[model samples]
Target: MSSQAAAIAPSELLEAARVSKAWPFEEARKIVSRLEKEGGVSRTVLFETGYGPSGLPHIGTFGEVARTTMVRRAFELLMPGVETRLICFSDDMDGMRKIPDNVPDRAFLEPYLHMPLTRVPDPFTNEYPSFGDHNNAMLRRFLDTFGFEYEFASATEYYKSGRFDPILRRVAERYDDIMAIMLPTLGPERRATYSPFLPISPKTGRVLYVPMKKVNAADATITFDDEDGEETTLPVTGGHVKLQWKPDFGARWAALGVDFEMFGKDHGPNMGVYDRICAALGGRPPEHFVYELFLDEKGEKISKSKGNGLTIDEWLAYAPSESLALYMFLRPRQAKKLYFDVIPRAVDEYYQHLAAYPRQDVKERLGNPVWHIHGGNPPAIVLPVSFALLLNLVSASHAHDKAVLWGFILRHVPGVTPQTHPELDRLAGYAIRYFEDFVKPAKVFRAPDEVEAEALQALSVKLGTLPAGADGETIQNALLDVARGIERYQDHAKTSPEGGPGVSVAFFQMIYQVLLGQERGPRFGSFAALYGIDNTRELIARALAGGDLSEV
Candidate 1:
């Protein structure tokens, strides 16, 4: 039997870029092939640039991880047997410069200055423990929710596992040479006793300086000077071990055998430094991609110091996780500013596009016509704006009445079968969620506090009844009719600006304003056809029953 016989309707090409011959798809394919051919380096391990002092993970943080995951998926598709490892590093050992607004007492965190990040106070408070613990925990929760795997914290693992010793010895072996390279930027007067690594000292404000001469790769031990200038030896206990901003990157290459990493353009200089150190350490600099920053709703750059940013929790409330994931994936993981407004449209578009992409893998195994039509080429589908408007219209219907509405949809859109989709389930969830979170039930028109008396008076005069027969399906359908007409009138007016007063349009829109208190909304005709005119009419009556629309 042919697969096409059993296949659903086809979707469309994702976009111009997705189908463009110029995309780096071939290069990506080559990298995976080469990595697989080499054998020792696990095709799985993809290094991620860590987030340290940045409180509350931002969408950009997720962007880095998601993009890596996409590339990882591509590898798995092309090279079967390959596993994926997304190494999430929290650079908590870095210095802390400012206290966020939420912290109760800034003075308490002051003692930890200049030391590595692990020494800082727990931002989530004592119950959760350390500052590093709180921030890392939040990040882990967000990523785990998004389905990322293989998380490792830089604060607690490296030293205990003897990961830093080889780098320390290499730094000591070329102490004079490495210092010479750092001299111009770090200044000639900078102390030459420093090894590239600087681990956090939980008991002291300054970083614990492990002596280069005492670092033992085999034993995982190092000696450093106490405040009194006397040398003391200690075992490496925490992963909060130091990484030289750029040079130790080479050490990372040597120590962890990282295959890939992504960073921002601002770190271009640091990347160069790491490459130099990588050469000095006889390790190849990890392959990398540079991505940009994410901005907020107002077009301002999100900054921790400026006290401007949105966290994952706030976004999840309004945006679907998959939509958010696609928003991050649509962009090239290079230096660019991702604006927030791009989200709503991105969400709509990605859902539509997924319907277009190949859902099953068949081109590799099967050489048949069914494969050609069903699995080879992408599927064509509706535009995003249209989809969102349609969804909004669908949501306008009562959740309890979707089956009948689906019948109406199937009538107009022939090929689109209304299967019990997980996405539709999610959208339904979103509708209820959005209404609860942002919708004010008594809102009159667009204003939150419009007078209820005025609404009641408006309804009384228009319908000639205090309230409609019932507050059930009948009233809702009547309200939906008004909302739908208003939208049509506005759309028509905008399309044909010169067109005069649309009485029918005005009447419908005014009715919705009188009842639901919105200027424009879901289609009344299609909605009536879907939910049935009786149900729609009842909802409006219930809303306006004896109540003055003018007062509402």
Candidate 2:
């Protein structure tokens, strides 16, 4: 362990966590306080997050697991020795009611509508045996990418293997009570057909949605009319029957003795129904947390069936998993856009938090997103340069490959190689991908107007006055000094609606537009610092001479 990490005392972490205002700490404290108030801690605390598996797992799905893991970490700190388990439960048995528009090439799923997901054929790969198996594997694969410690559970396996038989029977026993709580939440048509138990049809191999004609709690059998109008009686246990979505939610909680579970904001309205069902089944309802929804480009809530917004793989393609975690950690209860544009800021902010972690005291560190992201042990190290700076380097160099970026990086920071600076290497690759997708397509380098061209010439002269290896701050201040000397910028500094720094800001904006083809960017000096002071002068020379700024 690094000295910085070793210096963080466990006792200090515990004390800080007790008083920390961090959301995860607050959430974890809720669990600790609840357990204490309910007499004493006895059994293992179970943390659960559910996935429908009706569509491929998206980044929003990743958020729940990641956030819950953060809370679990905080809880461990407060309780010290209490046992905890995080179960990433997949509702793979849910009927393929609607095919997702975004999963790609799902025309084969139409004929299998209403069949359990596990019963449908795997459309993409033969290795998974069934569509449900395929999706469950996808969820597991994404979770595994982050090294999340979770027990994977499937609704189909749990139902078929009799692990849920006990709860299934209890659900049957309290069928009326569960129904009483659920019926009021449905529309008249849905209420007339709804049953807590849905019998899996032996003939059609689909979970039937018809009304239960006879419910015998004594035998745990539910009699329902099939599509053919034939009366069928099936035992609720042994996979012959499954509960409807809401009842299944409640019974799953009871069955697992879940101590804490989280669901989307959409389900916040149905919280009472789930809890009542759990109580009717003679089990205590676990604590529930409702987090906000993720939005697509139009500010519409992202839906699984609609398949909107970025997928887990899409986010990973352009940013590190740590950055993604940081995005999920910040203000989770408030809705935020989950699109390509958010990646750059998330990446830079994560680096900022990681860079700050070592210097922050216990309470301040507890509030840092990276601390929660890394479970209170954020890496004491960071990439040599910020992600924003790397993006600028990629753009200014117009390098098509990571090798080219590495060449530049090695020149600026000596002795760094793919082996010695792996983080820098990975960041370079991500920056290149981001640049190609988002930056390259949108780039439109504008020629500097007369006054701006003169400023650029002046800026280049000012930079040359500095030593070859001047620090980023010195280089930045010198560049600003040149801008302050420009007549147009000085006039704008007093009259600009944005205020005095508008002079420096406008000057920097002109530099970025002329050279990098972006509206805004990292401080020119920082980019120069990482790209090297001499290299920056060359870039300015290219800009002034109207040469191709993209080429080496």
Candidate 3:
């Protein structure tokens, strides 16, 4: 490999992107080879993807942004000294739909159903803030929290400065071509205004003076003459630098100098139009690849318009951002369905991948090629938590520390761990942050109810008494011993796979019920073994003493 060819994640995405599937294989290969040889290192590449401001940004919206960030990092790492920029364009120029549930309601939104996004109210404060401003702020905050570097807002300043006028005009001039591309893929009603490139005023029968080669930002105002012949000019303030749905996106891509972007599969036909448009417009269409949509637990596509979705904040409450990134990255973007039911597997699989990553020197010297799977580069530690979790446990003074209770996890879940698993840390961090940011009252942490209480009490008695003042180390070992005893019985049943003279699953579960004071606790052996026997016992004893040992 050339020194300039930096090692990236074990992914074929970039290589795949380079080879246009829409073109002939020979031509695609030739293009890919040329880029690899001549374009030895990418210089100042810009990756642009737009997010709409019509609703609370869903996980899918963030998924596109996260994917872009990963691609940018790969380029930076591979082509040392290369500059990569990821710009998230908020589509605030698009009209708003009905208000989202959690969005703030500004009275100003009612009159502007067909108007631009800049006219809508702030969704968060319900104050008279521009919709674009509100959505841009939210996305910026979300990305910033995840350490994303982005030149934000595609609508506001770009529209305000009229930078997109030429692009809009090109769209307008190619109105017939753009409509041809969009209409074939759209429904009858949608085909009417679907070509966002057209500058015809709905208020009057006049064409807006959109520039042909540059963005339209001059004082080209639209005047509306009402039914009674009353004339009014609403300044035609901020029209989005929007492409006419399909092919004009190709125009916008060239005009805006975008190198790469990812969109959902729902727009597959739209991308087809873009490819043809790219060839026609004398612009290299930014790589417009399709990534699959994420579905909720119910197997339905997550939708912001339907008022049914989980925001990044909600996901952060459960897992780290890094975990979320890994989850997003693990699958080929082309795969159809990415449901939330597999999140637990995503978490476990991520850690497993980390554990299996080439760590031993003997394996390295042997030239074990497992690491070369993703274009001869190991995957980026996209999930920071994976690194943190591995390191925290690997470097802990005692195994007991590894098994800290949920209460202690936030404070003691090593800073490095959270940093590594940004997604997981986001979840853990949110509980702490939500209270601080929202000024919500401290929710009293309570223990499990009576049935759980009795189960825990019985387990404690079975584990036997530890001498007073027993150090954390000793207590952890004893706990492990009990866990081992339970696991030993479990082993016998597993091998037999039928009735055996060993402890049954029900009986083993009972042992856990007694030990941790819950119907289920962390894996008994692993938990105690990692935390150390003494620490495990003490933590349990403390919980027992508190009379509030909750079922996690």
What C-alpha lDDT values do all the predictions have? Answer: 0.53, 0.85, 0.51
Ranking by lDDT: 2, 1, 3
Most lDDT-accurate candidate: 2
After the best TM-score superposition of candidate 3, give how far the Cα of residue 515 lies from its true spot, in angstroms. 6.4
Runs of candidate 1 exceeding 4 Å displacement: 1-27, 33-49, 82-84, 184-195, 199-205, 208-241, 304-307, 333-343, 358-423, 436-552
- Preferred candidate (TM-score higher): 1 or 2: 2
Candidate 3, superposed: residue stretches over 4 Å from native? 1-43, 106-108, 126-128, 187-243, 305-307, 317-320, 332-493, 496-521, 528-552
Across 397-502, the per-residue lDDT of candidate 2 in tens digits comes to: 7878899888877776767788876887889899999998999888878888889888888887888888887778888888767776676676443544335544
What is the lDDT, from 0 to 100, of the residue 349 in candidate 3? 63
TM-score of each: 0.65, 0.94, 0.62
Against the correct fold, how does model 2 do in TM-score? 0.94
lDDT of 1 at 236: 42
Question: Highest TM-score: which candidate?
Answer: 2
Candidate 1: minimum summed lDDT over ten consecutive residues — where?
364-373
